[model samples]
Target: MSYMNLIKEKDYLKILIAGVINRFGDSIDAIAMTWLVYSVSQNASLTALNFGINFVPTVLIQPFAGAYVEKLNHKKILVFMDLLRGVVVFLIALLTYFQCIEGWMIIVATFLLSTAEAFRMPANNALTPVIVKKENFNEAISLQSSMFRLSELIGTGVAGIIIGLCGVHVAIAIDALSFFFSGSIILMVKAKSYLRIEHQNKIFTDFKKGIKYLFHTKCLMRICLIGTIVNALLVPINSLETVLCIEVYHMGAELLSLMGIFSTIGSIVGAFIYPYLAKRYTERQFIVSFLLTMSLFYFICILNKVFLNLIFLFYIHLIISYFSLGAGAAVLSTYSSVNLLDKVDESFLARVSAVCVSLCTAAVPLCSFLVSFLSTFINVSDVFIVIAILSLLLAVLYSIISKKRWLE
Candidate 1:
């Protein structure tokens, strides 16, 4: 399907606009949040732990959030979640501006923001199929992914300038306005769903049903488990990114912002090319290709970190390695999401997405803690290399399983 078809679907286009606006705010918040955590707590381990905390509520709440969202109006859920997140961010901005913000306050703010997201994500995922044609799923997903990355690119660039001049509070306050804008725009969308199921059972029972359904599906639980570990291993690379930039290199927020800029550049390239790549490659071929590519880059990141000798080499390695890593990650996420959507029934999408999202979210905090814990016994750099190798081993395991036809 041509991207033009997607454009003509005005409802989906509205949703895309909402997504772009929302993610634009999120990109700004990401920078603010990262620096805020580190600024409040100077310890690298604590900073990583707090960074991971943003996703912790998703793991705990989304399974129930999924089951609950199954019976509700998805559009309203989107609006509510947007509003709720805006309020939380606005409060954070206010506290920061007042010079009354503490480390614990930042943690609470992140927790509340993600709590809204726990409910918001499942509803949005469930709502999408109703807005767009199933035939154009990959194309739409790719376009959405590309736009998201592009918005991040622009948002981070702008955020750096904002944070440098105005302050983190201003950047966060701007993000708050974006949420309000996105929520209002979504109210203009005319999407409705027939998938609001009436459940006789309690939410816990519905949660079990979602899990039971996964157990019955081929490689479903297995896939989520593997994804959890791989995601966990991959997270420390990002979770401790602040430490890497600040302590290791003596560079600060500029380098941190540059990292996001480079990543989004790679993500844009990857997202635009993914639909074509999906058509050209088998599922096994696609998975193996990205996994192997990611492993290669992880190795390169290690060499660049250890063999830090030249300023030119440092920037060169950062650009090339992160760009390639970012591209691999974007392609894998797009393919995996579309593949999961294809396998799931429309009615079960919210719950299943919640479960899948839960595991994926669960990985980050667990491993972020692991990174901190391991830092006590080994050098932080060593912890990174160990996790990178573990992630690579997942690729090897999947390659073997895929060859044996365990997965399509």
Candidate 2:
């Protein structure tokens, strides 16, 4: 089915709109939050710490959240989480507007936001299959991915303009409003309760079962490991992009926003192309090739003076690298979701998703910390090179593993 038809489904349409609105707000908030923290502290480590805090709560909460989602109403969980986040974010905006916000407050707010996210993510993932038809599932995911990128493109562009004109507080207030609007849209989705009555297991027992299933499923395990490694290494790169643009490139928020726009455009293109590519290549082939190519672009990005105009060259290289990374990410997300959905029972979906997401994100804080520590000792450019090399090694290692059928 076409993307239009997929969105025409009432439940899927609600979910899609809610997701897009939330992501748009999130994209704006991402830039605003990073800029706010960095501007306040003028410390890269603290900035990285702020980014790290967002994921740390998920690492600790997602498994439990997933287990509970199986027993609770997904819609209610989503709505409650959104409302909670909206309140917290708006409070933060008020504090900021009053000049009462502190650096630590941002970190605390991020942690709270992530706490809601820990449950909301798994619930959202589980809700998709229930609403979308089996054959249209992949299309729905791809469309969602495309919309995410499109939202990011628009949100980041608007954020840069807003921050340039009105400052971060206003941008944040907008994000807060987005959350409330997203919750209202989610309330419009009409789906039967996905609560599984047959499973009366304890939460810890369900968590354990999820972990056991993940490890026993070698393909899923391999994918999870690779994802974790990539996420860990990539966190620093993303967490420090503003630093790269402002500190290293001698630019301002406009440049940072431009980079975000270009990256999201690349992601949109990748998401748009995924369905066709999935038909032509095996998941292993698509993932390996994309990773390898993306790593190559990262290497190129490290060459600061490759062209006569260094800054221009950097922009060109960064855009290409982001494009490749976006494509790879889209493919990886689709492959992981489709494969896991087929492999795992529906009752276990939320728990499995939670565990997988947690595992993939577990090292983010530590890695962000590592980057912050390394920055104190090394050039940020040198850190980028190190990430590139590690990524290349990972791609090569995964290629060998695929060849050996270790991922089978």
Candidate 3:
């Protein structure tokens, strides 16, 4: 079935709509949160620390969450986590408005928000297959990606104006509202959830089994390994956008918003093209393209430095460069996600998917730390070039190593 037919399913459509609303809010928050951190600390490292904190729960909690999710109603997990995060975020916004927010509090907010995300991921990974047929996974995921990108584009484009006029608190409040809306919508979707399992093992035992299965599965392990490196390379650049705008561009929320819009436009283009590309090529081909294009995105970071000397050239280069970055990110993520969902059995998809994600995201925090450390010695844009070179080498290295019995 085509993407349109996939959308005709009422339950899937609800999930899709909820996702769009949720992502729109998240896109705004991405800018708001990062800018708030940089504004408060005026230090690149701390800003990077805030970014890294978002993933700490992934490493420490997701495997356990995955196993726990396997025995519960995934729908309930999704709804509950959403509502919990909505409250936590709203508290942060209120604290900000009342002028009692501290740097540590912001870190805590990120951690709490991400902890909820940690639970949400496993539940979601396990839940999607129940809603859509296996064959439609690609179409369904791609459609969501495209929708997410469009929402991100609009939200980001608006965030600059919102933050400029209303302040970060208002933007944060919008995100909180989005979470409540998303939770409510997901609650209405009817789906078969595995609420209980006979003789279910203890959570730790199930977590161990998921890790063991991941270690034993060559393809899954490879996927995780590749994802880990790709994510690591991407994070430094992604995490430092705030620093780049404030320090390099000497611009504020408005410029960050512009960058976000163009970058998300790239993501939209990538998602739209994925189905066509999938039809013509193999998974390895997609990964190969992702590798090169991601490196290109970084190399363009170096180019942006030159254009900074000329204001006019900088804006032109930024739109083109960030667009490339966003597109490459979308393609890799959509394909990898579909492949991950396709490879696992529903019996313990949450556990398997959680372990996969934990492995994949393992290095993200370290990369953020690296960004902080390296920024002390070199220019942030220099870090971008170094990453570009690293990504290119990684692509070449993986291409040679995976020539056979690999992603083909």
lDDT of 1 by residue, 1-408 (tens): 489889778888898998899889888888887887778777777777776788888999998999998888888998998999899999999999998899899888888988999999899899889988899888888899999999988897787778889998998998999999999998998878438566556889889989888778875665575466447656776777777777666776777788888888899988889888877877666666666766666667667765467878878988887788778778777776777778889988889889988976787888788777776577656766776676578789877877665555
TM-score of every prediction relative to native: 0.93, 0.94, 0.95
List model 2 lDDT by residue over 1-408, tens digit each.
377777567898888888889989988988888888888888887888788888987889998899888888899899999999999999988998898989989989999999999989889878878887777877787888889899989998888899889988989988998899999999888887475568588999999998998888877786676667667756866888777766776667887787788778878887777778878888667766766765675566556435436657677777777767766766676667666666776777899989988998988988988888887888777887888777788778877887775666
Q: Which candidate, 2 or 3, has the higher TM-score?
A: 3
The CA lDDT at 252 in model 2 is 76
Compared with the true structure, all predictions reach lDDT values of: 0.81, 0.81, 0.86
- Pairs with backbone N, CA or C atoms under 3 Å apart (clashes), candidate 3: none
Most accurate candidate by lDDT: 3
What does candidate 3's lDDT look like per residue over 113-161, in tens digits?
9999999989987878888888888888999899989999999999999
RMSD of each: 2.1, 2.0, 1.7
Cα lDDT over the full model 3: 0.86
Candidate with the larger lDDT of 2 and 3: 3
Candidate 2 global lDDT: 0.81
